[model samples]
Target: MTTPPFPAPTTAELAVVSAQLGRTARGVVGIAARCECGNPTVVATTPRLPDGTPFPTFYYLTHPAATAAMSTLEATQVMPELSALLAEDDGVAAAYLAAHEAYLADRAQFGEVSEIDGISAGGMPSRVKCLHALAGHALAAGPGVNPIGDAALERSTWSPEKCRCDDPGAALRDVEASTA
Candidate 1:
């Protein structure tokens, strides 16, 4: 059995998530993953939000640094390369299919939504569309879950193993000190 992905988000954690997002977070059900600095990196959102919108993406990437890194990877036009691999390798295709199933199963725990019944984000079970969603899934599900997500993360500049959120001001001061 797969481990549960959603861990209820605390009020303080929600506040930080809202700050990171630069807006109020809606339909956030849980914190799927956290950074080394203890900030929420991936959030599990509700299938059907209170606003009655059918939000299919349950595993939402929340960490600014990680989101920025995924954006950087996307800017590099790496999606085609990843998509090609999905077509060329049977093993990779199988793993991606499994990731789609896992994603659907995770979302189903909240309740079924017909609009997003078989739809998993980032074009899972077929292709790679969004690095942010894929990376979020990998972070939430942990290693060995989302192969494309893992590869995208591996090829990117960021790593969950390192916490870049630590002491931004201190780093700035160091730069100024050296320049002085």
Candidate 2:
């Protein structure tokens, strides 16, 4: 079994996360990142869930605002542009590979799941697949650890330095209205 990176999550933290996700947040072990208002922005989930499922996503973005921002970027086709950058810039490609390795290392600290081995979320070490996952890693690991994640965050409307935790659903509502 993988040991959690930190202590178990508090009830309040889990509640906030559930509210942000609009569902019961499962397999969450610790608060990886928090909003300025102390709400969970990114959660560190277990590699293996309670149901004997092999899960891959270690850092999960739980903040509604961050999720919405990443979704907006994906909707606007930012992934292709990031993929092109990976293809064109050897430095970024190398950094991305390092980021992938770092992600694997972080997960290893908890435990390893063979089914999800070598698989870091957001298509790490290659193309960008999910900005939410990447942004989660960026928030959890901090800036400069995940270059693509940092880039995505740079292009996002959300800012971690700011606190929008007061109304978790507000950002999602805004995203819905904008998309509508």
Q: Using TM-score, give the best candidate's number.
A: 1
Candidate 1 TM-score, C-alpha based? 0.89
Clashes of each: 0, 0
RMSD of 2: 6.7
lDDT of 2 by residue, 83-104 (tens): 9998999999999999999889
lDDT of 1 by residue, 111-169 (tens): 78998889989999898999999999999999999999999999989887788776633
Off by over 4 Å in 2: 1-5, 167-180
TM-score of each: 0.89, 0.88
Cα lDDT, all candidates: 0.86, 0.85
